[model samples]
Target: MTGFDPAAHLSEKLLERIRARAAAHDRENTFPAQDLADLKDAGYLAILVPTDLGGAGLGLAEASVLQQRLAGAAPATALAINMHLVWTGVAKVLADRGIADLRFVQEGAAAGEVFAFGISEAGNDLVLFGSDTDAAAQPDGAYAFTGTKIFTSLAPVWTWIGLHGLDTTSPDASKLVYAFVPRSEEDDGRVVTRDDWDTLGMRGTQSRTTELHAAIAPADRVVRRIDPGPSPDPIVFGIFSVFEVLLASVYTGIARRALDLAVQTAAQRRSKKTGKAYSQDPDIRWRIAGMALAYDPLPAELASISRDVDGRADHGTRWFSLLSGVKHRAVTMAKRVVDDAILVAGGSSYFSSSELGRLYRDVLAGQFHPSDPESAHATVASAWLGPIEP
Candidate 1:
């Protein structure tokens, strides 16, 4: 299917309804259940799954564009669903490279199964390299994960959770086991979802804490068992590449929306002293210009990087640096754009009801996601400077 347009799949009326639900969900601190259902009904959950597998058969570039649009309407809902898309995107990345290890993930997404990412843990900076969660091998070769996972998005509703843990009993002692745990209440009595998602912003995400006490990932579902730390494994590259790009897409969308709101406010509100629209004021124009300057390059850059990933263009060892750099740039730029937008919107924006205000709080969350500012810097430095000498 040539000339595929991802945007055409989602209707403006559908987006309006999702946008209408955003503030209410944020105010009530509730997940956007209806939004997720609507997106699923629209076949959004299967965007990356191949057409042959009963999906849209789109690529990262398309998904990134759609994510930016979704985030503009409702950031929390977009962010929550991003975790599920990450897994499906990773599965697509792997499949493109002749690996079908995650074909079930594709099939599951196409079948409307919700997959949540469960890799995050408290005090674990070694992300994807090492794990604080325990992975004990059972007599049947299956592994049991026992530990706490923080920032577990889609915590309230997930059919499967992809996670990792350290298996000390292995020969290397730091063997990281990567697998998916099914959401079975009977076999997994130890899994606990804490009712504590209250936060400064992005309240609709419902990213609660999860306590996994010996949650089981059957032997057949165990995807990878490799030494901890960096490796040439496709799984590692797939996750990093897809996760960082899609994440950048969400934040870039936030910036785009904030900038748009600022423009609208400037055009409508008049300055009392000058008795003219804020859009005519040199100062307001300058602030909006600054926001545009910061926001303009991001979507294009995101598109380029995403296409490179889809095209399987080889950046060799530079892939990590590129992925992390784009993510870092998007987050920092989005935050700046939102800050300028709030200033342009004036005191009215300070109200909790203001979408810009909520966006300001939501943009703050970009810093905390994986491959954070510090890690991105380190990865970029390592890419250019090589490993630092002892």
Candidate 2:
């Protein structure tokens, strides 16, 4: 029960707690404190850190599966925990593959020290923006940093924040630099959080504005100067594919639960509007059929990406397109399926005490989650169009 066993290693107990907290504080928009604590306690948060650092070292494939599974279990915690997982995965992948020796990031991750990333700026991709002057970096052996890194997904709960800012002195985008600073250190009332994240969706995410006031240290800095430029390597592309695949794969599970709830309620509840058995309607059958159809492709797309990554095959831009497509379709379909449930189930879906409301909002908002559909299309089109667009 303690070690890795795929199907048997499910975090049912932890997932239950997450579902509870998600429903409880979900309306309050607070951090999933208890759930996150459970994640660290159960070793579910730091699955990517090396064993030497007291972690599971299950690799990226396992990591993606775990994230996707948790999303089905609880989307709120899955998302918050995702910020931690991405930092750990990138730091570990970078270190182990001789890309960068972020041994400190590794040990810190195992100790339950959550690391956050600052890639979402005013105008760029949150997922490691491909910007030269638009990225984050450090100056020699110094920790104090200055840059406007916004909308850090886990700002409220993170210990270390991976700040990727533009190295003002450098012109080389290939030499992509990164810095890590303690959020506590930046809490001198210097950093600012704007209230501009009042979006119609994913409101509970608390993804607000983070404004840097001063400088960051050097020892805490992780990825020094590195050529983060163009590489057709699937491994490099796999890093991105993993998140896209996880997002898609996870929503696939949510859709199943939504469909289950809708169909089950149909048999038990009689619609006052029609004065007929809800289960006896043609619309109900068609809805179930549609949900079933929507549920099919997500896992297949996830499997395709996983199979490719596991095999270490060449990941062309076309592959990136496929992975992005999986994410795009999954979230969009999940939103559609949940919206239909709301329409069919009516007032029952909005009952605050019910799972339907929370799940519906989370799943619906998930469609707009940071994985950019436009960019995914662009990344995919790069193959057919040839080279990245200027």
Of the candidates shown, which would achieve the greatest TM-score relative to the real structure?
1
Q: Count the backbone clashes (under 3 Å) in each candidate.
A: 0, 15
Off by over 4 Å in 1: 185-187
Overlapping backbone residue pairs in candidate 2 total 15
What RMSD, rounded to one decimal, does every model reach?
Answer: 1.3, 3.7
For candidate 1, the C-alpha RMSD (Å) to the true structure equals 1.3
- How far off is residue 370 in model 2, in Å? 4.2
Q: Give a tens-digit lDDT track for model 1, residues 249-364.
A: 99999999999999999998997898999999998888899889989999999989999999999999999999999999999999999999999999999999999999999999
Q: What is the per-residue lDDT of model 2 for residues 1-390, given as tens digits with 9 covering 90 to 100?
A: 136565433557766666667665566666667777777788876687777778887766676667667776677667666766766766655665565556677788888788775666666553453542343333555534555666566667777777655554556434445667677665685466555655433444556677766645455464554455555432345356555666666676677667777877777778788888887888887886787788766666666666565455665446766767778888888877777766667787778667778778778655555566677677667757887657
TM-score of 2: 0.84
- For all candidates in order, the CA lDDT equals 0.92, 0.65
